[model samples]
Target: MYRFLITTSKGLEQLLQQEIQHLLPEIETRNRPGQVVFEAELADAYRLCLWSRLANRVLLQLRSGKGETGDELYDLANKVNWSSHFSADQSFSIDFVGTSRAINNTQFGAMKIKDAIVDHFKDLFDTRPNVEKQFPDLKFHGRLNKEGFGIYLDLSGGSLHQRRYRERAGRAPIKENLAFAVLMRSGWVDAIRNGDESSAEIPVFDPMCGSGTILIEAAQYAAKIAPGLHRHQWGFSHWKGHDIPLWFSLLDEAKVGQITPSMRFLGTDIDAHVIEIAKDNANIADVGDFIQFEVADATQQPNTFEKAGYIVSNVPYGERLGELTELLPMFKSWGGHLKQAFPEWHLSLLTSDRDMLRQLRLMAGKEYQFINGNIECQLVNFHLDEKNCHIADKEQDNHSDFANRLRKNISKLKKWLKTANTDCYRVYDADLPEYNVAIDVYGDWVVVQEYAAPKNIPKHKTISRLQDILIAIPDIMQIEPSQLVLKTRQVQKGKAQYQKLDKSSDELIVHENGAKFAVNLHDYLDTGLFLDHRDVRQKVRQMSKDKRVLNLFAYTGSVSVFAALGGAKSVTTVDMSNTYLNWAKRNLALNGIKGAYQYPLVRKDCLTWIRECEQQFDLIFVDPPSFSNSKNMQGSWDVQRDHAGFLRLVRMRLAPGGTIIFSNNLRQFKLDPDLQDSLGLRITDISAESIPFDFKRNQKIHHCWVMQDDA
Candidate 1:
């Protein structure tokens, strides 16, 4: 009998052993951590390789002995007859695992074993096999621990999880073997086994099937298809002792083992592109006809199966804070959809984050832990029955005060919003200091900017409060969690404010008083468009008609777009960032405003450009940042300290009868009180008028003033 060791994921050793025993009942099997050991014939090893869906690799053990040092390891490996394994002309490779006292590095240990094997072959035939790393003729696995070292011939070639069917995959695709194990844990395999193929009672469905890994696995398993039937090559293919006829016999049996079982499987994804990838993968697996791939939103898609069976999916667990915030409501909504549409059906969801499971609100009947790659995950099962389905809104749980306050604020803003003709506005701005977050709406999306909690508040308490806030917002705002973007608002210095927090570039076009601007909620700390400055942008439009308009620090060109639409003869926009400048251009294009001659985009530090400018404008808007120390600028600038000198330059650029609208968000800003007399200018503080109704609660969101040259 040949000694063999089978490797699998850490938590799946027992399941893998059970699968192996069922496939080869005569073998003496023993389970270990991430591995299973058994004694079987060479043909039995091949059979297990062909049938064991949960095993990663089927290794044929050749030798095991004590090897405390590199020399000892070399001596032990050299004791084996190298010629008996393969001819010296065949290429070979070693995958060494673990460490020893003298051979702490895997490469060093592999080198020692490699030297021993080469010397053994050289002594016999005066030649040795060439080392081929990628596709070797014979692959060897070396492992060492405190007990001893063992060498193995890798008979499965590569990891069995790579079924070669999924040429394309979506984000965080589950491995094939793990998906199978999930099916087994869900009792899906047993259901299929008992049900008649002619009238299949069980229907498998995945609402969020990215590349369709799980659904494809289920379809293949239900159809009695061998997991390794399509694999053309094996680790034993080129081995000297490999019994070709026996391997062929096993391969033929696997081909014959596949039964044309009727399957009721369907997979769907919200993304149409990924659905095409899923269809391609299913076709490659030869199960395209047995399954249907469709693009449908999980939150809205209802159960289509005539009879309830199983709803299995690897629900997306957002990795980033913004993604997590967006997915929370999605989980809640999907949970509600399942409760309403697929009641009495079984639901199994795999996710990496345990906290996300709570968003479902459905009581998980059974939860099993599994490992996908290096990440530990949980497979939560739910029996969607009346008893377990807690579909009531959980927003009022422990945060009813915040929820009521939010509802009150939204109610108060409803009339004002209709009169203001703005769809994007602030729904809540730290109404209860305990919440400490500003929630803004941009069309259908919501952005939650959390101010850093006080240092005295415990971290866990802050996290709990934040979670409560996230849970309440979606239900109250009547939006999905996927439409919410979360960001931490903190004091920024230097160029830190301008640096990208993410690269999603998920920009959305939002309208304010019929003017459209592109806003990206996911990429930066601040969205491209500022809602607090909405009234100021409108004022710029009213003041710029039939005049030359200049917008300094033109962030995203919102003011410039408004000015252009307001019939400005010409508008000049200046900013140091090319990204914002391009965004400004897009905003203009969105409103059918274009032409460099009519509206010029200048890329220059606003502070330096103000000193060098010779052109005069009838209307000028200079809204500088509170603090800027961009590398592109010459020196550091603080609005509180530098306002006096900066306004002097701005005043110089104002033409006869020109009006300068100056603004800044520095809360403690005291605009040089004496600058009016010193620079011969009349400064009118419009901070109150510029403060829109939505921002009346936080009156100091920004300070605005209208300045005019006094001759």
Candidate 2:
């Protein structure tokens, strides 16, 4: 028997534990910061190494040893019975994780330990052991924790989480462990595993199953498919103490348990090509014989399953999905379909968009807050019935969010609106004046007036001031310009800029730098104009000439205009929204620019559009929405989750000498550091000077980066 520890991202620890627990009837799983430790015999370890979706690495316990420093650790490790683990002809490697007072240097400790093992062998058998860093027969694991030290042998070659089925990358795919948690929470897989695979007790359906991970998992579990049957190698096989006969017998036993289920799992995705990938993945996992995969829109009919079953969904939630207006209907439509078609089914929806969650008609039965990698998300469980259980006419949500300042200060503004002879408006007035902000929704314009005292004024001089409080309340918070009801807003204040073209425009400003060329401005109130990135634009402009440039989300084509103005031979501009695409065209015409915009006027969602294309530019520009949910783009696509996919998609299109400028306004912009090595992409943070002068609220409005492929 092998004792195995599977490591996962710190965030998915609970989820991984649940997955392990669900896998075996008496499975003992323990979790630490970034790992899940389990009691696995030789077979269990081998099975885990092959099948764990959540476990990052599976480590088998070796001889436990302790030490203070490198020398001490080496001396301790040297005392281990190596002859029983490996022969003199075999090679080995040592990996170390450090924390603690005694050993601060991991490499130093590993080298010392490696030396000790070799020297120990030399002392016993008159020959030193070989050091194989890349692929060693036996891998040793050592960790120097704050309190004490521990040692183990890495049984999993790559990592337990590496399902080995995904061909390359699927867009914003759910992590394996989280998928398991979602499945377990829904109770579908449990029913099947508990003796109901043939009954259709609750047909498990993943409507937005991109690559069919959950579906695959359910099929494997129902079929009694041991997760560890597909691996090429495991660390235990090389260990001297490994029970090879026991492992072989266990594999044969588990293999014999495979069921050619009549019809147990179903996975559907909207994108046809993606569905094909999911099918390919099922085949790779050897579950193709038992699982079914297909292409179907979760939001549309005919594709929707009417059978009372469990539905697990993860829809689009960000810019790639469209905007809030688009996302709202998607939620409503999905809710309507589920309620109408599957009354007996329960649903577990995983998403990060709070706005979308608020739109769901189903009363949330329970919710589990978990992370999908870096993003915080909610796993909302919906107990489905034919209708809302305690159903009543849902009132239009006229009440301000309590979290909204408007609610806190509603009474004060109520008084002011009456005195000021203002009717039909959102009034929020309070003595805690700092929190006071009043807003009136006039047809086309929303008049948001603020009240704050001026610093000081002489008694003789007339002084009046209206501080900007409604600044946080954007005019287009919930609707589009077409949807905008533009009743006139009558505010008793300074004259308006004659409705200063509130929408993004065609005019763009240019900033030039020597190394590359980029736009100083776009049509967006944000070129398509983020004034915060003035310095970055200056860098792009300077670097523009003779550089092939590509700009994504190229609103009003500002970057393209700038690159052209900077004398680049060609510039490509891609945007998903037609309004923005045409705006780019208009900006180009306004700037007297041409080239690159001729063919690739990508109207499809940027993420999807980029995924299908293969064209490279010397310098590529990527600036997408910080947060948006538009249905036209198919689904929500958060930049953070979508960033790597976007980078991968766009980098493949970049020329050998090209570079990509990735920018987003997300305040807590987290550029995945792993992207550098994982995607062969290098990003340099250029957020410091991206802000422009005119719109200077902060020195940094967004984080910008210059991404380059390895030369």
Candidate 3:
């Protein structure tokens, strides 16, 4: 028996082992990280090349010994009978992997082995073989490390993943063998292998079939097609010991063993071009009749299957921030479509982003990690049924407590929400310290801000708790997973907090009291409207009648809109961000408050603008960031450090009897005790009254005060 080595991708080692054992049960096998080792006859190798769908390459070990130095590698290779493996008339190539202290470069090590073989032939036959890099008549693999070296005869010409049926490929196409691995993880292959006659008739479908890699793999398995039947050449084709007759006998067996599958497979892709390519690939693989390819959007595709089966595909998960926002709605709608169209079907999806899985609103019973090409991805499996069809409360100990707290908070607010005059409110505020996150409802959407867990907590524990909270909140809040947005809220310095989280540019309109304001929950960390300041904004509206208003650091101008609607003579909004300024404009126009004269927007650093301003207003509102080192300003501004001087400058711009409503969300914030004497103003602390009823759980959400001239 010849000792053979089989290589596969990371995370598929165990699967490959199982596949090999099933194919050659008599062979003694062992498993490694990315490869498997076994002792089998030559015919067993031939059988594996034809049948093993989860292997990358099958190699026969020719020789192995210590190769601590370059001379040792050459001596080890020369000891082998070179003519027995391949004749000097044929060309060969060496694929060297691993390196040792003496032979650090792979190319240099491969050159040493080639020289040893050539020198051997020259001494015996007075001639040598030529080295061919590509399309070699014979290929050999040499690996060298501190432990030693092993020379292998590469039976498969290149990686077995190149099924040769793919003449063209789409973007980021998965390898054929990797696709088979995914099928194994999804349990599609096992169901067929160990199923009854009726159980084997379950159909397979791929909704996002890019170039048909997944569907073609499923079809080949179902139709009993050999994975390597389409390849024209192999490393053993020109080997001296290769028995062409034996290879042909195995090939004939594979050809005659194929049978028509009982069930048909379906593949759909939104791109028409990709669908045509998939059709061509399917035809080349000889499974065209088994699979039906169509050009249709995955989100809107209607299920035409007579019975529930399996839906397995590689769902598109955006790698960039902007692409994620665009894909959110598609995943949500597609998830809804699956719930409505295919109720009892099993769904297995592969994605690089875990967030998209949450968007599906389906509870994954199992998840497996694998490397696709270079990307580390997750294969999440879900069984669709009426009970768990939609997002529901999870009963795990980690999840129940958080969900129970959210349910209790929502129960308390149910009556108050109906009469709160605004649909936006806070539902949960870290009620359970172990689950440290704040939840706010903006009409139909829920924004969850996860505060950084304490350093003493384990990272994995924090992650587990956060995931449990995400799974639980949707059900308690009575919203779809699409309406849930999660963000990490840590102490941000300078202008980092204001930087855009995503370029979704998506805006939603929600009402407060009688005024309408636009808020974007996805683009930035803080949605334009701060729900905790509901009471403060109303106070501003009630006090702004017939007065001129100036809103400093007016983020999206929520307060300015309320002031304009309160019949202010004129409103001025100042902020350094042109993005927020434009957003403020949209908010004003959204509420029918327009015209530059009535509401002027100035894009200047509030600190710099307040110093150069010549106009005075009857009312001024200052809610600057806790700390800002924005590039637009000459220097940074800290609420606690600069509030005294900052308000003194504002006092110069204040009309007599005018009021300045100043606020900040800094939890440890303290009003400058000497500001009353320093700015010559009477500062009344209204922080207690500023927090809305829903935010009572977190009294430090924000601090508010009404400052006026001490006349």
Candidate 4:
């Protein structure tokens, strides 16, 4: 019997050993972290090269001896009769692993091994073998440890994991061998390949199938197809001792051994481009007929399967803080969707972040540790039974807590809501630390804004709490899910505040203080109406009577609508986005104030417009975004840095004794002292008076100021 060493990933050694033991029960085996050693004949070696899915390389141990120095190692290699393994005209390459005191540099150690092989060949024949690093005819592998060194022929050549089927790969695609390990650990291999008739027919699916690696691996295993059947080259093909006739016979046997089982394998990805690539890869593997690939979102996966099966996926594990925040609720929703749709299906999820897996809320039955590249990841397996399908008891407690807080806040705000005669108000503003979300009511609709959780907070905990909030809001408020809009609030940079979050151009008319304004909850990051500014809009209306009003940097012209409704002589609304300008006109029309002469909307750079305008206004409202760098703007704008210049321009167009109202959502804003002194302007901090009762908890939501020239 010949000795063979099969190398796999570090954590997959035990599974590899078990696989080999099953394939050749009588073979003696030893397992290590990344390697499995066994004794078998040439036929077994050929079989392993053709069939073993977890092995990266199948090597034949040519010789082993002890050596301390590079020269000694070269001598050990020289005694192996290099010319017998490959001809002088054949090209070869050497791969050295591990390190010794004398072989500190792997490249130098490889040179020493190559020197021995070349000298041996040169001594036998006048010429030596050529070195071919890329596609070598014969490949040699050497391992140098503290004890000595072992050299072997890399029988499988360029890693067996490079299954010839994948013509393309998606970002961070799991290696085919690792995908095999995932399938094996999930018990899918046994269920699809060797299980009883009923188990063999169970369907397999991957919802987040990137380039369809898992699906392809599953299809091949289910079909009893050899992993290496389609390979064009192998190290044994050119080896001097290779049994050509025996190898061809084994290949023919593998071809005939493929089982056409009646099994279904499906793969879906939200990215259509990646789905096309997956199709190409499946076609290349000759298993396209066994697997179906489609562009589908995991959140919308249908429960059309008539029978229970396995759902395996490598869901996205965000590597950065921002990505983690975005992925939290997505994982939570995906978990809920899976529970509601596939209560009987089993799940195997591979992720680097265990917290993300916990967001699924399903208790995993088994977890296997594996190294995906350098990241330590876990393949968590779960059997979704009735007991574990619902939200845990602790999660229910969180939901109750959120509900109680919402009720308390609403009760406290009832008096203010009645006095203001407004149906829309802030019901909850992060009342509890765990459930950090702002709940606003616009008539029957509720908008839930989730503040970005601290980086130290576990993503699963945040997601669990968010799920609790979502469940609590509808139950507490007695509204449908369609009326609740969820949004994530993060520190936006540049023009991110103005950027559209979705493509739906849906607009709804909502009442605020007996006035009608158009609001869009689905199209943009911020709904059209700012509920916190309800009192501020009323203040603008009270002060705008018989005055010519200028609403600078006006977004949707809600302020202008209030000014016009309060009987302003004329109102001019200035903004950069034509979309918002059109929205401003629509808001004016909604409020029964029409005609361009009544409320004129100007779409232009507010800064440039202010510079060129000569008209004087009795009241001017400037509420520039905290920061903006829109392509239409002249240059980037920062409220803190450019407030002086922007205000100076606003002052130049203001009539004597006229008031300039400035407001911004930058919580940390500080007015420049020099501007106050230089412009001789009397400024009052009206932030406290501008805040409505519903926003008492977070008074710093915005800062407002009224500036007047001390003429």
Work out candidate 3's RMSD over C-alphas: 6.9
Question: lDDT of candidate 1?
Answer: 0.87
The whole-model C-alpha lDDT of candidate 3 against the native structure comes to 0.86
lDDT of 1 by residue, 554-591 (tens): 98999999999899999999999999999999999999
Supply every candidate's count of residue pairs whose N, Cα or C atoms clash at under 3 angstroms: 1, 67, 0, 0
Q: Arrange candidates by TM-score, descending.
A: 1, 3, 4, 2
Clashing pairs in 1: 326-481
TM-score of each candidate structure, all chains considered together: 0.77, 0.57, 0.70, 0.65
lDDT of model 1 at residue 444?
Answer: 94
The stretch of ten residues in a row with the least summed lDDT in candidate 4 is 320-329
lDDT of 2 at 71: 69
All-Cα superposition RMSD per candidate: 5.5, 19.1, 6.9, 7.6
**Which pairs clash inside model 3?**
none
lDDT tens per residue, model 4, 1-711: 788889998999999998898878889899987999988899999889999999999999887788868898898988898877889999999998877667788887788889999899888887998999998999999888765888899989878889999989998788888999999888887776677778878988899998999999988988888999888898899999999999999999999998875778999988999999999999999899899888888988897777989998877886633345446556767888988899889899999888677667788899989887787889999988997787653456334777877888878877776788777788888878888999888778888888999999998789767766765666678876667777888988767877887666777778877788888876677788888888889888998999999998899999999999889999999999998998898899888898788678899989889999999998999999988888888988899999999898888888888889999988899989887776678989999989989898998989988898756
Please give the lDDT score at residue 199 for candidate 4: 86
Best by lDDT: 1
Query: Candidate 2: which stretches are off by over 4 Å?
Result: 1-44, 47-54, 65-68, 125-127, 195-201, 262-264, 302-306, 319-325, 386-525, 528-711
lDDT of 2 by residue, 141-170 (tens): 887765456677787766665566667446
Lowest lDDT 10-mer window, candidate 3? 390-399
**lDDT of model number 4:** 0.85
CA RMSD (A), model 2: 19.1
